[model samples]
Target: MIDEQTRSLLAGIGGFDPTPGALAGVVVVDVTRVVAGPYCAMILADLGATVIKVENPDDPDYTRTFPPLLTGEGSEPLSGFFAQYNRNKLGVTANLRTAEGRELLERLVARTDVLIENFRPGTMERLGVGPDRLREANPRLVYAALSGYGQHGPYRGRPAYDNSAQATGGLWSMNGPAGGPPTRVGTIIGDLAASLYGAIGVLAALRHAERTGEGQLVDISQQDSVVTLTENAVVAYTTEGTVPEPLGNAHPFVRPYELFPCRDGHVFFGGYTDKFWRISCEVFGGEGTADAHADLSDMATRFDPDVYRDRVRPMVEGWFRDRTKAELEALAGDLVPLSAVKDIGEVVDDPQIAARDMIVETEYDGYGALRTFGSPVKLDVTPPRTRGRAPATGAHTAEVLADVLGYSAAEIDAMRQAGAI
Candidate 1:
């Protein structure tokens, strides 16, 4: 564990203090290739759990073909998008279709504490690394699987990605501008949500296994996960027979709760009460306007949004146009519930993000320093660190087998010669 390179990295950062140990002593065998699975593995890796990313030779992270390669060269092999998700771990490739590859995997599993994968339902079972087989190999191994609908459902075997989950999860139904076409969220929300839950399940299962020598299957359904975020939309549908529709930028039940255009960007003013609405009007120059009427039951009462929108829309538009984004934000003195829309650059440079180490640099010679996201989770005792740059495909194959799996140099060369990796 006393790696000179790792120690040097710890020293180069300003607040370097070496830890004699890391959390839980858990090692994750990551068979997750794309977004959700890789993202979950990365979280475990960031939390100081050793994660070994497993990929096949032919389809070694298809994200490498994504635009804006981390190397940023013409037709480079490494994509920035891929690097974004795969950082803080070791990458190894194998031709899993081969018997040698499967044997090698079974051997690796003997020492691995957890296994994570996001394959179509039954893919692992077909490969003989399914939940039952894997548990048979190591009964104490926590196996987490991510799929579209779930391990079993009408849609279990259907193809699914982020958008598919959003549509099926009832999330897309509640998105977009009011009366506009239902829209997908701009972010890969479903994938990220599932990843976060997957990581949580992995650690929880690991804890259980440590306590009782019992490992269980983590069945992650992306569709169900996105619905968790939709909250009352699901409740309203279940309780009131209401199908939630896209309310655009506005909240479904709250009037004047959406963004208004400023001279620069948009300023969002959210006051959930009529008293606050009157106060908002006093500030935004809409005091006695026809649109800014008070229901007395107030803005919080679920009422016809059309009436409120008609009363407040013009006044808000006129006032917002008179001020720049900064001036509008400033007027919310002592916090009048306002925020200006900011782009990614602004988010990256904001003082708060910098203070929290929300960004980290990956060192590569030609790439120099690659700016990527940092861990957001804060631990009081031992916080997460940017361990290292992502490894190239098969770059650590020989090294990992020799060191972690006890393969000889000659054995690795033989595996290489046999096209097993």
Candidate 2:
């Protein structure tokens, strides 16, 4: 159960409701840093898990120094980038290199429902706090490991960043213009996908633990996660002997399903299906255009490379060239299946995004209201929400140690004196 003080703090944050969250009583020990692992823990935290974020005292999460900082009264500037993924977590620091720090971690793990980490494959084991040891201590503990490769693969020990994962996982090879050099994705899709998958795996493991009282390991690989998103690209090569290549913003097998340039900006048109194609023809190609192109009504004919390149592309480009994004967007509907391509600035103010409460603001003690994203998962009874500002380094160390592990003030002080925290 969350203590009253903690609950009050959460309530003060933006987007919190009086109702208890879905994972209210669950305890999570987040021993991860940076994007992938932190993001996974953040998802659980948003769902009301009591996530205790543990960092190494000597070398904290490097993202803590990332740009776009925020400063509160008498506190060092905090990274908005770090805050984006670390909110709603109690922060604590422990120098795991010391025996005292390792002991503290063991105690915390014994009481934790889930433990997530993103260190290299054997880093935890070398520190003597690996899954085998911790899960032995607590039979119902769910241990999740997020890494670039998995725990047992040949490349498991190799270092990887988002671009490295994208490159090695085959996503980069197929991500650019048809004949252009391979390009990295604009966002960290590799890390984000792995984090999402890691969260799902942790949830599934938690359910299993609840039913059988048995703990398990959830090993998520960024490379594997990225490969899963390739969406039939591998199967196409294996089954039909056709290697996939980049098509820029166009769909590999769908015609008129790509972004089109307009007078002011761009709009994505999705006339791939027969029904939507007819609707698009009526809207863009004018009144009798659908009938005039009756011979190309079938997908096979319209989607053929030669036909699309020579006929359909030119016609669609001609239709879009004279129109403005707003003019094209006005025709968007269920039948048309089109929308204006939105930049970040436009997305923040979009009515649909606003209606969904995707943009949320949280107030810090001295820093004014800071806006970040809202939870995508919405449950009527116990909704997931962003419930607080990110903590300062080890801000909740004394509180968590006392409340969670039943440590005395003297013991905490002794450990602090020894530089264990």
Candidate 3:
């Protein structure tokens, strides 16, 4: 059961309470902009943490001005991109350049359990809220910093985005075709990966703080996070002196592990072992089962690139090219591992994803209803829920000032007149 104070807090902020999530009573002060830091804070918010998103009144998060705006008939417009990452948060505008603004932030930090920021290495220190200062105010606050490069390094002060981090961290080199030009990933994986790691670090630090009454800084680098996705690139180079390159859609080690062109679209299938290979031969119905191809039955022979490219893939491609997606599904049944390549529209409308509530409809003040991706981590006991829509710019400014900071109406108006919030 939720406490009356928590229920009133939720009601005052226009937040919903679908289920009691893991971080019900936790408070997060999110002074982050752009994708990485906001995403980390959103993850905590999804788990029922009360996240207060701090934005500068002069220069708000850049995404607030981005395109694809959702507007009501008479209300203001809101950016869909901003709403996607900043959901279930209380938005506040504070001019950090002013003394009053920093005082407000200091007050919020004193009672917050966690704080997330993605500014450059020394930016927080310049704002007079560095780790040392924050620790003095609240020793048990879990402070997290998400950056392109880590806090201490040669490239710490250098600027980097998702593309830069991907290029510097070997993802660009390891992607694309075997001999083709370097290609960027379709999405901002570098920033997103760093956010996930940063969120995990915050959770762990919070647990530590809960037990020992001490908190530490969590520093996550986008470049470092992107490097972890290079499947076995490091091991191949360090152990065998082999620098791996992209093999298109095919696996470097597994044979028949590639995308095949079908009649209408594409399908990816894999069958390496004898049992599955025999099943694959039946479904493919080609020279893959001939006596001349007997040597290819062994996993080693199939693992050979020449054998796979010259003999195996050709047969499979020919078979798949002649069959439709439905026919192949019926023919293969569940014996073989196979799935048709789907586009974004197909994925969004997929029955499996729909059944699992992967896409949900949430309502905002200006935007009546918006469709957004739901949380992937689902716990049986206390599953995370999307309580409410993303807030408008500085929507909870007065409410937060009154409830959290105990600022009277006159004081709030005075600060606003001073251009502090």
Candidate 4:
């Protein structure tokens, strides 16, 4: 039940009631496998596009066979890996090698609004269904290619995964401690970023097609996407002739902006400005502490590397070490930017996360009900939703051919006999 205030807030905004996706009538043919491509298609599916996962019969998505299968007494074991990123989709098999398969794909392309693939650069063209040929068939189709090195580059042919992208894009250099060896981020940021950029490109291209009925290609490379995230490092190298070294958890230009030790674990506090610095000093002690930091009153002096190393950081560390995380949060609630470093368990139970519905429960076909992440993108109207569990391999092949393509039962059986689906 919603309160009066909450009800009123939702009443003014349309699309609050659950409905079909925002991209409802848009048809997407996802020919990509693996994280980046499947992740992008998943976002589109969440937004209400009717996405058909086009897989080859010989090697279906490897994730579909990945380990940690969910099993029950009367159900076929399902791959949790595939289910994670392939939710809310209709699955089909198209051998692309056979003439009948190619014909079927061509027919699907003729009616599709968007087709995405993340195979090697020339794989699609070699398959006789490249962007140029598909666009010729459907003038308003958005052809999106997500690759490791992009369509054309000196390293275009080089194979890459999340690890290689992070290394090649210079993200590995700036991570970890000052003198420590390079570190990979715990999460797969490179792959995830590429998907986000690819999704944005697809949406923008769809808008352009909607207006003029002319479609274009969207090319996104994981290496390039990771490089874009090295904004400060690029600027420093180009403009200042400086090579930045890792400062552990510290910000490059801000003092008191790093993680600090607390009684139980770790906490982060930011008191970069003079006003916050003075208040922080008062909180630490009072007049004595203020006098000690009097020379570091201005922003320039406060952030100076030498001053921060010799004085500010040590003082802050010592002050933080004396207090518990809860104590510091209470004392500096709104006075300074402070946060406790929470683990995964804490994050799951966090009040703010619960309030925002950042984690939601979804029912997997064979796995029963499980908790998965909710969409971070919140549109007061037309919010993204999880349609259902990920489909079984070629689960919709017969259904789609019959209902969507208007094929007769005999035609569907013939195609199956010929191994075209």
Candidate lDDT (C-alpha), each = 0.76, 0.86, 0.84, 0.80
Can you write out model 1's per-residue Cα lDDT over 163-247, one digit (the tens) per residue?
Answer: 9999999899889987899999999899999999998888888889889888899999999899999968877878998998888
lDDT of 2 by residue, 250-302 (tens): 89888878888989998888888888888888888889999999987887888
**Weakest 10 consecutive residues, lDDT, candidate 4?**
8-17
Worst 10 residues of 1 by lDDT: 9-18
Better of 1 and 2 by TM-score: 2
Q: Which stretches of candidate 3 lie over 4 Å from their true place?
A: 1-11, 286-293
Which of 1 and 4 is the better model by lDDT?
4
Q: For model 4, how many clashes?
A: 1
Stretches of candidate 2 exceeding 4 Å from the true structure: 1-18
RMSD of 3: 2.4
Q: Can you rank all candidates by TM-score, best first?
A: 2, 3, 4, 1
Q: What's the lDDT for residue 403 in model 3?
A: 82
**If scored against the real structure, what TM-score would every candidate get?**
0.88, 0.95, 0.94, 0.90
- Candidate number with greatest lDDT: 2
> If the candidates were sorted by their lDDT against the true structure, best first, what order would they fall in?
2, 3, 4, 1
Candidate 2 clashing pairs, residues 3+ apart or interchain: none
- Residue 60 displacement in candidate 4 (angstroms): 1.5
Ten residues in a row with the worst lDDT in model 3? Answer: 1-10
Looking at model 2, report the run of 10 residues with the lowest lDDT sum.
9-18
Per-candidate total of colliding backbone pairs: 7, 0, 0, 1
